[model samples]
Target: MVGAIILWIIMIAFLFFILHAVIQSALDSSNMAKNIQDIRDYLYDTKREGRTDKRAVAEQLLSTQPGAPQDLYEECPACGEKIIQHEPECPSCGLRLKD
Candidate 1:
């Protein structure tokens, strides 16, 4: 009887873990979908606005941080290249980095 109870407890614990993992994965997927939708909307808006310099807009959206110096330069961790503020693509390795 004790062995069966132990087995049942283990099964329940396993199921709880599985459910938690599944729920976490679903939440992550939902968040990713929302981010993609946001990017799509931003692109559509940019196109509608007739902005010729979409790269500038994209760079602004991707890199602009409050209270940050505009001309400040940082060394890239990947290629050790000096990168300026508001730049996303690394000049050396073309790595998409968060500025």
Candidate 2:
């Protein structure tokens, strides 16, 4: 009788462990799906806004700090698009930067 009780207890413990693992996996999958949907929505909105340039979108979304210098970016001479100060070439116009 004691052996039978021990076997039942072991089986119940194993089942509980498996049940918790499956529940955790389900929650993780749900969170991943939500994250992917959010990303899809964001990309769709960006495309709807007619913005194909990722750099321009990032620059526009990033607000400069109050005490930041103003010369951190410059316009590309060929296309008048904004370029980071240290970039060696303009991504939009393909113009070679001298400085």
Candidate 3:
């Protein structure tokens, strides 16, 4: 009788562990899907704006650093717009400025 009760308790604990694993897996998949959708949206917007280079898109996604100081701003060669020296592309003309 005592052995039977112990077996049932062990089984319940095992089931709870399985349930927790399933919930965590589901949440991870949902987060990954949302991230992919966000990247797609960003690519679509950039393409619609005439920025078609895939390398440029990748670089933009990888770069998260803030722009240089305002006093360090320089003229964009392609569009003549004032841009920070550290910018990878010209904001006004979509021209690639950095190597």
Candidate 4:
């Protein structure tokens, strides 16, 4: 019968619609996972690159960018590390200092 044939066509169309929606949902999930993975990789690379030569790559910036005696500190003779006037020895190089 024509009615039965039409009913079958509608059922097949509905199944195709469901299949298309499932495939689209899967693709969206995959894309979101890929985006998260890329962000994790970037952070990991930054940490790895900063693992070595931390001292050499560093600068001892003063809190007030010292120009006066109040904020000034002693400098290390061996490694040029700044020593607070109150500190008896150089913290960075562990060298003894004269008061």
Candidate 5:
């Protein structure tokens, strides 16, 4: 009788553990889906607003903290597009700027 009770306890514990894992996995999936949807919404809004430049989108979404060093930008001679300094090639015209 004691052995039968122990077996039932172990089986219940195992089932509980599986249930907990499945619940946790489901919650994680839901959270990930929500995050993806949020990103899609943001991208749709950005496109609707006519802000198509990669640099412009990045600058708008990311800001340097106060007292932080700022990144330098210079105009590309080939296409006149403003590009980050020290970049090897112009993103707009694909001109090689340095070795």
Candidate 6:
């Protein structure tokens, strides 16, 4: 019957929308993870090169235009290394930066 066909079409369309949304979310998360990894690598390289003045890089990393928090850092109390915000402790030493 036409009614049954219409119902099936509607269900199919709803399923498609859900699938599309899930796929989009996955892609967004992947991109964000890749970006975070890239920033971490860049920061490590900069630190290894003896470039301690990383305020600029931190600023760039925290820029909201890049979808990150502003003025947030994972500063190490021991060596004063500026790291990303998500890190609970200093990557260099296991020192807790925040209380």
Q: Report the C-alpha lDDT of model 3 over 18-89, residue by residue, as the tens digit.
A: 999999889768966667677788888998899887556656655532452336568998889977667899
Q: In model 3, state the lDDT of residue 91.
A: 77
Clashes of each: 0, 0, 0, 0, 0, 0
Name the weakest run of 10 consecutive residues (lDDT summed) in model 6. 60-69
Candidate 3 clashing pairs? Answer: none
Tens digits of per-residue lDDT for model 6 on 1-99?
999999999999999999999998897689677786778887888788887754566565567246555557656768888776756677667787667
- Candidate 6, residue 25: how far the Cα is off, in Å: 0.6
Q: For residues 9-85, could you state the per-residue lDDT of candidate 1 as single tens digits?
A: 99999999999999988976896666767777877888899987744665665554445455566777799987775
Candidate 1 — worst ten consecutive residues by lDDT sum?
Answer: 61-70
Clashing pairs in 2: none
| Pick by TM-score: 3 or 4, better one | 3
Misplaced by over 4 Å in model 2 are: 32-99
Stretches > 4 Å off in candidate 5: 1-40, 64-69, 72-82, 85-88, 91-93, 97-99
Candidate 6 wrong stretches, greater than 4 Å = 31-99
lDDT of 4 by residue, 5-85 (tens): 999999999999999999988976896676656556755664688754333222222232334346556678899887676
The predicted structure with the larger TM-score, 5 or 6, is 5
Candidate 3 lands at a TM-score of: 0.33
2 versus 3: better lDDT goes to: 3
Residue-level lDDT of model 2, residues 1-99, one tens digit each, is 999999999999999999999998887689666665666776688899988986665454333233446666889889999888767898887898975
lDDT (tens digit, per residue) of candidate 5 on 1-27:
999999999999999999999998897
Candidate 4 lowest-lDDT run of ten: 56-65
Q: Which stretches of candidate 4 lie over 4 Å from their true place?
A: 31-99
